[model samples]
Target: MKAHKSKTLIVYSFLLLFCSCGLFIDKDCFDSNEYKFYLPFTLSPAQDTFHINDTIRLRADFSHELFDSITLKYYKVENEPLMCYFYFFRIDTTPTPHYTNQFSIEVDTGNVIISPDPETALRYIVYEYDKSRYVFSVKFIPHQRGVFLFGFGSEPQQHVNFQKKCPGELMDIYFTTNDGVDNNFYMMAQSPDSSMNAVPQHGFNRSGSYCFRVVE
Candidate 1:
């Protein structure tokens, strides 16, 4: 009986040691600090104003980042009929026609030598109503039309490398109909060259003249 009790105690000790070691290993593997890298830059529209059937381009300049690898994800507003075609441009060169039209798409911006010129910039275009919005529904009414609101999502939130370390921001671009008023609109006046980095404001309607009027 003494020997059996000793064996049981030895087994319990081994089990306790195994569990403690496993807990430590998991803690080391999943340290949140290790994955706390900030996003390189913020996303904005190359041209602020957009209209029905207009091809909008969003640009992000990462020419000053040290990291070469990045993962970017795009999301759509919930319960909204809005859709966008995403395209990626490596340099000033024209991006390929390949595009993903969906509620969301992911892109891996591979490593590239950073440069100061706009050529080194990455461009994303959101195309809405390739043919006509009316084609979707014969009863489509002008006033009932919706606007296009699309933006980017980053793994680690974007941040500006300032003295105070400002967190990076994202602004959704709106493509309002010619006659319809979009109260959610805001002016994206910040030029790509501006030193102040933040997502453009929301809630100011973009002028109608900047948008394309589609005629069916």
Candidate 2:
């Protein structure tokens, strides 16, 4: 019995030692005062704007004292609300046509460089009708038919304004000659650039004219 008890005691002593060492290893050293607090990550080109056919640059920053290596994920707004094409901002490599993937980088002991490639996301609409007439439709309305206008435009501020002055807030105006389907009218406008509208040799001109009707 004495020998059995001694063996049990030895086993208990070994178990206790193992558990104590494991506990010490699991203890977090990062919360201690020996290590200073530093920002681990940063994002650049945080606030920027882009026009058609314009390119934007982006960057990421990090601290050497904080991390040994890092893995980053990139994302951008797509065709739902805003249309934008993202690309890689590679200084050493050639530019690509598409950007729909996450790029990974290995940081040595110091800084990791990440470059963003942003291209024009949206395209404006312009169509040709005749020498004196042109058609234009954009995602957002333009304040006035002009070469360049930014942001959302007012409906009334358009080249041809539509208003309801009748008893009801909504009114309709129509004319009939031969048949209801054959007699209809559509409003048209001219392009902001007169020369771009049509060829001058064809005697085509748009002089801020509106309320033009079409016969079918």
Candidate 3:
């Protein structure tokens, strides 16, 4: 009877260990999934140069392995009039067509909020078609003049690390010349928490900033 009891206890202990290991694996999987969801998208401009008070249009695009709904956030430095346009294209060969509602908010304090238009009651379909892609454009008139930067990312907050300040990842796009001359291209990054020291964030992960210099 003593031997049997010892065996039972051992078996129970093994089961407990297995369960704990399973929980640990599950937690790791959850962390990876969350990280991918927060991954930033790509923001590109048609051109790098723009004149002061000129209407600038920027293109934001993203592609994912799986079809996931995404919302883009746009930021600017100077308070200016802003407009956003969204386009969805189904890359798969099919007769049926999918549509997503797009919406944009009025410019306020150098920031604009854009999302799927609620009036259409449509969600941006990603996985329904092969290699689906979404493209959006942001139009704004720069009131201030100088070396200015603007960018779009998954994060809604306005934060970007400049070259001279905190540098890590390419977080924003710079616009310098208006006539497509004297264009500057570089990477900028910022820490999610401003209180932290000016250190490169690990994995080059952080929020984005729209830094631009408006010159008269």
Candidate 4:
């Protein structure tokens, strides 16, 4: 009786497999199951700039991978006007940052974050902006590998161990270009707690050595 039961189970398994294969082999059935869903934006923090009253310039260089159309939005805290323009003719292909006459910003002190929403797959879009001068140079995404902490020392210590979460870690970074033309990207995590003795928080970690470079 046990042998007979095992044979029946094997038959059922084969039948299930045959049915599931219809999803791929059965074109008509597959079309019926077709559905459209929201595809998340594929973009990274290409580069950041920080400066005081000095002009902040940005030039974007893109590769074929960035072929998809991108929508860019610039947001600043106060009523500050952060100017921006898209350069289609000239794209700076070097490690240096270039300015465009199309974009300009007028702000006393604050941060300007720009996000590009590319409605597609692994395609990417580069965003470039500048500030007059800032306290320190902004840190773009790390190219190295190691665990990182964000919101560190604050009430909540948020840490990033890239091994666990890759491409999804949140960063609280600002930009600066005060030192010199060579931009210094620093790794920093925000303080999660307001008191002492509390564990500090961080965003993510880098597993390898990461050099800050333009994605173009």
Candidate 5:
């Protein structure tokens, strides 16, 4: 009886040791911090007034940092770290294009180097990228005269101001982060960009076209 009790005590002690060391307990350090995802990207040709028929380029090189920051903040010292982020802040890779007819976008294959191929689905434009890794560069041509709202789920947001080639500087063109779908939003503006009613493009999904404009 004494020997049996000693063996049971040893087993219990071992279990307790493992549990205290977190070997048998929660080993993954959870990351609830959302601010680490707020990596702002810069828009090429940062302008207060981008004109029609202009090629606007977008580039950002903080994807690796965005992931690493969370990894470091949440689970750097853990034996087996399971890092989880709440929101995604990269290019929105919608199966269907989520852009306005005012501008057509494409990856700058010449200036930008995408290795192992970036992501693009059937009938999807190059704008639908997985992540703007390293130097993610893309160019968009403005086809019409109005403001263009960036698509929802599109993150690492970029803020741009547009001024049409009009007489008085009354803020005719603009770029925004919110598409105003279901009243969900990321960044909020002061007066709000004019809601350019959603519409279907040549051969794209209308609902995914989360961009709007104010043409006067």
Candidate 6:
């Protein structure tokens, strides 16, 4: 039974990657004339911390129009029942903290979609958006109370070792430099809770991070 499910899942994944919107690309990817890129815009939260039922605004601005298309991925953060990586929820005694399982808030990307909806959405592009070029914005209300994080990369913590875990969210920015440049799709993501910065977050190796706390 498990094997059959796996096969079905694989099929769906292919459909989403191939059938969805299309290949991600940009015009000005790597221009020799244009040297330095950027964090784009700092994703500054409304405040350093939030409270239950408090709405948090996460927004960033672009200095230049770099992304002809940006693939924005989201996970249903609030009111979600399932929060496990396994195809099926794991049956174990491991105390997986709520923060470790999923994001803390419900995200609403207002009509920002560049990809078409697939028949079996469960298989690919979980949730996608790229319509906006000047700004990346979302409004969410916290569901859980504690220090929760978003995005991928690595951090070290004592007692338990966690890295390369599934991301809370991910953004793939395809440049539209319109200039002869190297082929590279830039990425923007946040770091989950950890101590050591093992991988790149917010574009570079610990260039910066967005860590938030929620209270009841």
What is the TM-score of each predicted model, taking all chains together?
Answer: 0.26, 0.23, 0.33, 0.19, 0.39, 0.34
Model 3 segments more than 4 A misplaced: 1-49, 66-134, 151-216
Per-residue lDDT of model 6, residues 1-216, tens digit only: 999999999999999987653434222222211111222323334345667777655444443333212322122222111111101011111221323222333344322221233321111111222342334445556665555433222112112111122222232221211121211112111223222233343242222234456678
Worst 10 residues of 4 by lDDT: 202-211
The candidate that wins on TM-score is 5
Clash number by candidate, in order: 4, 0, 19, 44, 1, 12
Look at candidate 5 and tell me the lDDT of residue 48: 35
In candidate 3, position 148 carries an lDDT of 35
Worst 10-residue lDDT window, candidate 2: 205-214
Every candidate's lDDT: 0.27, 0.23, 0.33, 0.25, 0.33, 0.32
Model 5 pairs in collision: 196-213
Candidate 2 residue-wise lDDT, 24-139, digit = tens: 54233222212111111111122222233232222212212221111121111111111111112111122212221222222222232223334532222222223322222212
Which rank order by TM-score, best down to worst? 5, 6, 3, 1, 2, 4
| Model 5 agreement with the true structure over 1-216: per-residue lDDT tens digits | 999999999999999887776643223322222222222334445443456677765543433333223334421111111121111111222222323444566776423222232232112212222343333456767665544434312223122111111122111111222121321222212113322212223111212322322233
Give the Å error, residue 54, model 1.
Answer: 5.4
lDDT per residue for candidate 3 within 1-216, as digits (tens), equals: 999999999999999998876764533233222111222233334454445656544433433322212213222222111122223212121321223321222232123333556443332212111234333434556553334333223322223322122222123222112222222222222212232223233222332233333345
Better of 2 and 4 by TM-score: 2
Q: After aligning candidate 5 to the native by TM-score, how far in Å is the CA of 23 from where it should be?
A: 6.1
List per-candidate RMSD values in Å.
Answer: 18.2, 27.8, 17.1, 18.7, 15.8, 18.5
lDDT of 1 at 208: 19
Off by over 4 Å in 1: 19-47, 51-55, 59-146, 153-216
Count: clashes, candidate 3: 19
**Which candidate would rank higher by lDDT, 1 or 4?**
1
User: Model 1 over residues 100-138: C-alpha lDDT tens digits?
Assistant: 221122333311222234442322322222222111211
Q: What is the lDDT, from 0 to 100, of the residue 167 in candidate 3?
A: 25
**Candidate 4 lDDT, 58-143, residue by residue in tens:** 22222211111121212121211212111111112222222222224332223433324322111112233233211112222222
